[model samples]
Target: METTRRAGAEIALTEMPDDGARGDVDAATQIAAYRIVQEALSNAVRHAPRAPITVSVIADAADVTIRVRNAQATAVAGVPGGHGLRGMTERAHLLGGSLEAGADPDGGWTVTARLPRHPAPEASEGTL
Candidate 1:
């Protein structure tokens, strides 16, 4: 959050359960969620410095969904690659989740990652 703010962009966070409260989530899931936000903010800060960015997290009984979006910036150049996306994707995947990062056809970029409440067996400590 501070990352994008420091870069001159306004950042807002929204949670599904409402009131912005983080309720009953596991450590690994929480860490993965934080990392996803961190990486998304890093990308916006570096590429769309003055754009508006929103981070939304939705959690239900079975899964947690996160979406980060930066407003369209006509001034930003041809776009950047990598930008911690690979690490973010790996984090999501390790948590029995999936991630998608892409530029919006109209403008800007969006990153979405979803993690399951009960992660799969393959997402073990050694696998990470």
Candidate 2:
């Protein structure tokens, strides 16, 4: 949230997932979540300064939903021509989840990802 605020955006965090919602997560999952928010905020700051942003994290027994949206987006820094979305998507898949990022019909940009409540099981040694 501070990232967006620092980027001149009026940020609003409507919801944050509780500890219970996080469930039995692992370090990689936590890092991925943090990175997703970091990249989203950075994009909003770099491309759409002064836009109002809403970020929410909702979690259930099975998965957690992360949403970051801006009211309007301009071509200040061009489209996602970098590794931002790609990295986020990779991280999502690593956690057995999915991420979707695109422009909203409301003329804003939105980045969303759903991550499983539990981390992917580690492959046992000598097991395919």
Candidate 3:
């Protein structure tokens, strides 16, 4: 996947099971969920070179979740800010989803995102 992306410079790669939708997931939601994983992988590569990146997507009757983890990045010299993490969070929020990013106790950093099966409108229907 990385090699293919590198070849195109601007292309992004996504991997998912071929079993079709687990439940009620729509096309838009699935695309957004994959984008979250793609962005997370890009960030891990760009910010923590040489670190191993793991991406996983799981779907069930209720939601789709994406997880990306990488080893801790050693502090680099003279680097600027990183908006990849922030941008990912914003994307999740915009889709009425949630994102979690933090260091793992065993070592390394991890990001897990969950986007509900239903769209925002349907999800918010009964909220007070």
Candidate 4:
């Protein structure tokens, strides 16, 4: 949040679990979740400078879901196409999770990731 704010974008925490309320999510899952949001926020700021961004993290008994949505770009400065989205998706898939990113129908872009709270043991063993 501070990172985006520092980048001159208006950001908001639309939803989040209480501290320590994430339940029994593993360390790998936790780390993946953080990285997913990190990349999402970076993409938003880079592709839609000055746009309003809303971030939401909802943790349930089964999985932790993250959504980062930004309003239409006020100024797009990057050349586009980077490893950010791919890295984010790989992280999720490694943890038996999934990620999707695309432009919203109305306008703007949104990235969503769903990471299992208790992933299968073999899923992270490079079989993916």
TM-score of every model? 0.83, 0.82, 0.71, 0.86
Per-residue alpha-carbon lDDT of model 4 for 1-128, expressed as tens digits?
Answer: 79678868788886666446556777778888888888899888777777889999888778889999999776565556789998998999988899999988878899999998878887655422
Task: Write candidate 2's Cα lDDT for 1-128 as tens digits.
Answer: 77557646788886665667444655566667778988888877777777888889887777778898888766575445678888888888877789999988878999999877666576111111
Q: Model 1 segments beyond 4 Å from truth?
A: 18-22, 75-80, 121-128
Q: In candidate 2, which residue pairs clash?
A: none
* Model 1 Cα lDDT, one tens digit per residue, 1-128: 77557657799888778334456566677778887888888887778777888999888877889999999986457765674988898988897789999999879899999987657656635233
- Stretches of candidate 4 above 4 Å error? 16-21, 74-78, 125-128
Model 3 global lDDT (CA atoms, 0 to 1):
0.67
The pairs that clash in candidate 4 are none
List where candidate 2 sits over 4 angstroms from the true fold.
16-24, 77-80, 123-128
lDDT of all predictions, in order shown? Answer: 0.80, 0.76, 0.67, 0.82
Better of 1 and 4 by TM-score: 4
Off-target runs (Cα >4 Å) in candidate 3 are 3-20, 73-75, 122-128
Tens digits of per-residue lDDT for model 3, 1-74: 46624633232223466347664676557666766777776666666666666677777666778888876666
lDDT for position 63 in model 1:
81
The superposed Cα distance between candidate 2 and the true structure at residue 76, in angstroms, equals 1.2
Residue 17's lDDT in candidate 1: 87
